[model samples]
Target: MYHEQHGAPAVAPLAGFTVGVTAARRADELGALLQRRGAAVLHAPALRIVPLADDGELLAATKELIDNPPDVVVATTAIGFRGWVEAADGWGFGEELLACLRGVELLARGPKVKGAIRAAGLTEEWSPTSESMAEVLDRLLDEGVADRRVALQLHGEPLPGFVEALRAGGAEVVVVPVYRWMPPEDLAPLDRLLDATVGRSLDAVTFTSAPAAASLFSRAEDRGMLPQLLDALAHDVLPACVGPVTALPLQAVGLDTVQP
Candidate 1:
């Protein structure tokens, strides 16, 4: 109708703009969303999600928990929690793991984690509505973790200071590494994205996770373009993140972001 009235179609908000996507999972979906807004999307996954199913580390941790049975179990993310159970299921100990967790004080970091726990036929003793690991940590400290065995299910990378703080409080913390964040096997696309970023060719870059942001910065540093990349991001390129957590890496380097 507007086109009919004006003899031309409305201009898309993102028309003539280029955006770089750095997500490994659901990258196509994100790129599609950006493209729908008329943005020229450049997809370069900064990192890859490596599941630890065959890595033996996850099995070892699962076995340790089954044998030792931690006093408190903290589920940090829905996918991580689900992946742990799925991996255990593949190893023929899913039910055993659930039974062990049933006896401990289970804690969920947010609603999604709570859903995963419930889906696994278990219930959380408590969950923070704020969806914050910090809040969960504070509660654990307040409840006194001295001499307590706590099993923390990590999503990808370690939560900054969380394990250290728990250990400092005399809690025997067993880290369950369900998955890992590794640099993408193919670095060519990432290199191209970095070049575009440093050249100020891209209008914006999207980060879905903190690891992706960190990986991008690491790559830039490795190529000796950190300063130039930082300058471009600071002045010309817009860094957009899914949430505050995903923005941590960018913020750590003294850069601001647009969270949507």
Candidate 2:
């Protein structure tokens, strides 16, 4: 199909499609990619990334780590790891933290985190190629975590069964809570997107993270439109996810999703 709009051709693969984006980080880049394919982009950030309070638990954790460095450090996400280091820098313990980390066995969840570790003048002893935390846990267990001090860097939410498993192995697990996800301060755009989804005005919705998916569901329930939203998502609108982890929230509710 071809349409002439202001002397331009709308013959792209996604022409005539309107896609909804719910990612807060890199939303502009994702939106531009969809638009380049001729799809009308509806940008609605479902959640916002908020760093934890400066003088709160993060500072306490940093001080404790400096006083008692862990035997092993697991860096999960690149951004979260960097944020932790930068936050420590703000507290005037950046060099001390770096020196402490240099003495521990560092494990990066994936390449991005490995880069973050290396960028901080540290090297990772190991990293999983599949980028699965399960693999990292397995390595830790197989190598023996008993009687070891392990520090885990959290991205947003706690990893289910991760800390529990470490504790079960008799390892002292210290969770480094970094950034967290909160509902966007401006809900107008999200409200509009919700309305469009229920009205069948959106052809597809893209999810980059599980929290965004869950936040959308929570907002729909708050408005008492859960059934309507679920019906539209189940029948009319296509749900596109970036990866399997991001698809978990949708899958848990029996919603089919495409990863592309």
Candidate 3:
């Protein structure tokens, strides 16, 4: 299929598919893009966003970093680290956090994390070739973690195995939980989305983030709808992803994907 964009036609494979859009925010861009291609959209934002509250946890984490200043600061996501640092700034310790950053090498997970690290005014010592957590652990361990202090800003649901591996490598790992991804507090819309997908009413199901896909599946499974939902998404439903990273776990679960 081909698309005409800004007066120039684009040869695209996905010119007429009713793709899903699941980005956390600023979704209108992708949604509009898909609409122009003569495809219907389903806006089932599976992940809920919550800004940090009660600065105590962040303050504690920052003080711990400043006092001990981890040998490696592993940032998993750009948005998360920026939010963490901004909250730290609000606490009047922005410079102190930057001072602590200067004492340690930086390891970012993906380009997003790399951008966040640069946003913090630090240079990257290393980052994973892939955004996947497994790759990040492999690279950091290769470098050496023995008796080193490492701080991790968790992205979603905590990568325990990665944390466990670093701990096993004898690194004192401290964590900063900037945000969490969970099911919508109300299950009505999600419940409806699940039924629609399972019933083959949705034209496509696009996921911008893994947690959104995860949230849907988790809820469906709890309600005994996993197998059905998965089957529907695999066959009649289209699974579109914004990028390779967003496509990871969905592919892990056998969902065919169309990438933008």
Candidate 4:
């Protein structure tokens, strides 16, 4: 196993290093890969999946829509839509849910999501050039969303900010968060990983998503260990991000990310 130096101009694998894995439910998937590659794995799930509120609001929204479906739906994630479909089923509105969007304005966010939509037997009415949310927002804005009834099937945490933005543009947004991304309610297990990183005990850390990186640093910051962890990552430890989004926040901390 070779050691990697910071800004070394390579995205090589660290075979003999210990890394903090920050995937949510798929931590094991990543952990298994790291183990197979000969890296000591620190299983730290920076995100947890939470179902949306079971409030009757969604049911009422479904009933009203079934009786009188709307003009468009902004299905940001296909995974979220499946959950929405299942949730609506228990409420006995799955057919209503599908029928409502049979031939209305439909916008897909990303290929991953679009794949899910297609597998669910739905075709795209409109697809964006990019997978970013802001881009999707721009598309909707350009087309004029004022007084438009748009349903948001969000998978992440509260985007009240997004809601406000849509409202500002005159879109009547009704949201159903199929899932949420949250830190481990208990950080006890991560304490060891944090200690190893802060004490310079780890050789590297791998981040799978932007939120994973953000959550780790934010928690370290809140616990007064940000300096140590940041130092370890930038000067002594290697940081690998799965994609561009995960790499963005790494730059703010003065460390560039290596994607593998």
Best by TM-score: 1
Could you tally the backbone clashes for each prediction? 0, 0, 1, 0
Tens-place lDDT per residue, model 1, 152-221, is 9987777778899999999999999878889999999999999999998999999988899999999999
Q: Which lDDT tens digits does candidate 4 get at residues 65-162?
A: 67766667778766777777777887777776787878678778888777877776788777776676777778888988898888777755434356
Q: In candidate 1, what residue range of length 10 has the lowest lDDT sum?
A: 1-10
**CA displacement after TM-score superposition, residue 218 of candidate 4 (Å):** 4.5
lDDT of 3 by residue, 1-260 (tens): 46579999775544555555666567687777777666666666677866665646667888889877888888888988898888888888889988888778888888888988887898888876767777878877888889988899875556647789999999999988777676677777677778888887778877777677778888888999999988998899777776666676778788878876
Q: In candidate 2, which residue pairs clash?
A: none
- Work out the TM-score per prediction: 0.94, 0.88, 0.82, 0.76
- Residue-level lDDT for 68 in candidate 4: 64
lDDT of model 2 at position 111:
95
Cα lDDT of model 2 by residue, 49-127, tens digit = 8765543778888889999999999999898899999999888899999999999999999999999999999999999
RMSD (Cα, Å) for all candidates, in order, is: 1.9, 3.2, 3.8, 5.5
Better of 1 and 3 by lDDT: 1
State residue 126's C-alpha deviation in candidate 2, in Å.
0.4
Those runs of model 2 whose alpha carbons end farther than 4 Å from true positions after fitting are 1-10, 52-55
In candidate 4, position 257 carries an lDDT of 74
